[model samples]
Target: MSSHLQAHAAELAHGFSLCELAEGLGHLDMDGADDVLIMGICDDSRHAKPGYAMLCLPRAEGRASEFAESARELGATAIISVGIPVDTQLPSLHLDSMGQAGTLLRRMFKTEQAGAHLYGITGTDGKTSVTWMLREALSRYQQQPVWSTGTLGLMRSSDDIRDIGNTTPSLLTMHAMLAEACREHVHSVVSEISSHGIAQSRIAGLDFRTAIWTSMGHDHLQDHGGYGPYLAIKAGFVCDCGSHGGNVIANADHADIRERAPASSRWYGHGLSRDDVDMGWEQELPGMLRLRSRGEEVVIEDIPLGDFHAENVACVALILMVSQDIGLQELPELLSGITAPPGRMQDVLAGYGQVFIDYAHTPEALERCLRAARKLARNRLIVAFGCGGERDREKRPQMGEIAVEFADAVWITSDNPRGELPAVIASEIEFGMQKPYRAEVHLQLDRDKAIGEAVAALAEGDILVIAGKGHEAYMEVCGRRMPWSDAEAAEKYLRRKNSGTGLVSEGEDICA
Candidate 1:
């Protein structure tokens, strides 16, 4: 791997002092940074900077501490962040677009055309799965991908998984990643285009040939300000990528994206109806699916569990379909290769029946996931879900309604209640239950307890779905995050129960 790292190293690894870095980007010729004395930058802004010393700190890890440390490590004269107050004077430059730094770094590292190919997948819910799926597919051809999730930060698919900080990575880091890929002569980069990344314009300038929309869901209302704005932010990926753009795989099932696809792009994919598709497909199993189009038949025996993943497979198949250089026929054999994403519809056995852990935090995704799970369930469908703190509140009641509508029992619990009261977020979601629920609904402020209780309550044929915090390894509470894995917790409880310790039931587990 040191060999791979050396092979993919970015020239931008060479750092500069504050003045030199500033001089390198001074007096830009572009829209966002021309003659604009950088005051600082928003994490989301990703406009062009012909010449301007832009401070590039965005991703959660790119906060003050990391930026100062990186800048210092790189021998930068000065670093900037929001933590610097107006009252406290420092050698500072502020810009509206921190993403510009990504562009500038791209240029410095020549990441724009890293010999290593790059690919991106975006949608509200299935970004991670598609990325993983494609990474697994591409690997059969001996290509290792640098992957990232819309929720978690960046990483590569090598044996020594390297964490790249942000989901898409800082421009410098992304450039570095691609540079590394280029050095390795790898074929692709499978990444997710998050709305936050889009809103902030972080991935604005990348050249993507293959783009997939697994499914659409509402989210980031607080960041994008509203539904319309949020949609626009998400549409940026397909809409904005220039001529280097290749085939776009869209979900024919999503109304928001049915006709609203990226402007002037090739289309492919299957759906419930083939009215507007080039490839047709459908769900075959909770984590498996099949797609058939144009003498091509791809059967994914054990794909991944999620209402929208089949559509994601269609999109992925479409990408392979269009990539004449790639073999689309191999999909069937490779279909069964990948496993479940860590938290996205993952199976956990804690108490009675099967426990499903998913990262479905949004109303649309949660409802669909539960409804889908109910179909596979022979007995009770138990849902353990909650919304994140300081996120869009409007979806709460809607999520509540979906929970009540699908699951036989509902347990409303905390999910990343970052700085917000768990009760407050829970109450909003509870209000959305349209009718009185026939199933049981419990409220346990502690997430682990909720999982334990839900697990305990599951019968032989029962299914428990823990939504929100998908693929996330930790749980956030009161501004602090401790180690927490929904799958692990459920599995622990189930193992204990299976080991003759006990059966999980409502209020039975002391943890619950």
Candidate 2:
């Protein structure tokens, strides 16, 4: 990161004065220098910096006030307390809700995007792919700098790209990115909205011009506490978009999604024709997808990706049609060359088989990846996957069942077993299958070794799908994120095997 990029990063890390923040909060008891600059907003004291204002919240360790004292010791200049006035040397502002205060900070800094069209995509899956398509389409057709942030991090039309490490970043980071985008004179902005982001008020006050709900499925059950709350969080994004007078697009294939999404939302799906559905896609040729909407049809030719991605393309097309006024005639050409983000159904060549790296951690996502691989596999489909630790534990078994049902041979392995024993997570996954499938399941806690064994097992015409931790470069185990990459591991293993050198490449656990 250069100094210029650092400044932009700082822009995402916003700063505001105590007085301005208090004004935004409306009913806050403020005692201290109103002019003291709050140059940073942080929830964790560890991230606190000089002139930063720490928001005291209830953490597992202690209450907000307990952290406030430590933040002051760390050079934090101010504290925004929720219902508790910490006795710190620095000034403290009391508010009823810290989440509300987070929203206010964004508003006070005026980070709301201006002078461009803002688009949002929310769903369990396909958010990154749909947002990427929209970014590429908008940039190509409009011929302006288009910016996008989400699973792929920040994508500017220029060569520079930065990953913010979260699908939906903190409110401060989102605001800062929007502010920076506005400064760069970007013409279009697309963001992937997560259910957690919506429920946590991270995207509060963002006024989108258009929004899309790709599809609904089970995910993040632990974060939302239950499935109902999880669904509500996703619907909240749609409601917010509608409230802001933005056009909402949703997948009509799922009846629940269509019913829960904003009533005025346009829909896209397969084999559907109705006034409500604005677009639909079907297989018109052997290797192409045909999109039909408004009595017009466009054939997307030679799409090299999976069948599951056609829905993502249709969703993006509908969003563009509504937001950018791109017709079917020109839209197909614009979308012809769009590519999937790294690790989302990404295809790489193995020694005698094909390998796919995908971030499909959930059951539905895993199923989709396996289905896609099956369509392309000539002989058999081999899958290497594992459930993430510290997430919704219930999904672990479901994902295990899905992998075995779709893949001929299954390798159950470790996927970022953060703070949990890898063997424990693998055992829970193995618990999901019956005798037939369970008999075929192979457990290798080492992900690299699992991938290596999977490739070695693949026949000439077989396809290998490596799920969970797609583009991520680190494997977190016991609170440590060590450098690891599935794609790099696959490439190295194949190259080594091709050279008749050895199955094990340079470096220990390169693929494991």
Q: What TM-score fits each model? A: 0.80, 0.87
CA deviation > 4 Å runs, candidate 2: 1-21, 28-63, 66-78, 82-85, 89-91, 98-103, 272-276, 284-287, 350-353, 438-440, 501-512
Candidate 2 weakest ten by summed lDDT: 2-11
Error of 2 at 139 (Å): 1.3
Clashing pairs in 2: 12-176, 448-511, 448-512, 449-512
In angstroms, give how far residue 108 of model 2 lies from its true place.
Answer: 3.4
Cα-based lDDT at residue 346, candidate 2: 78
Off by over 4 Å in 1: 1-103, 142-152, 242-245, 266-275, 284-288, 295-298, 324-328, 349-353, 503-512
Error in Å for residue 38 of model 2 = 5.8
Q: Per-residue lDDT tens digits of candidate 1, residues 411-481?
A: 88889999998888888987876544655678887888888888777678877888887667778777787
Model 2 gets an lDDT of 0.76
lDDT (0 to 1) per candidate: 0.63, 0.76
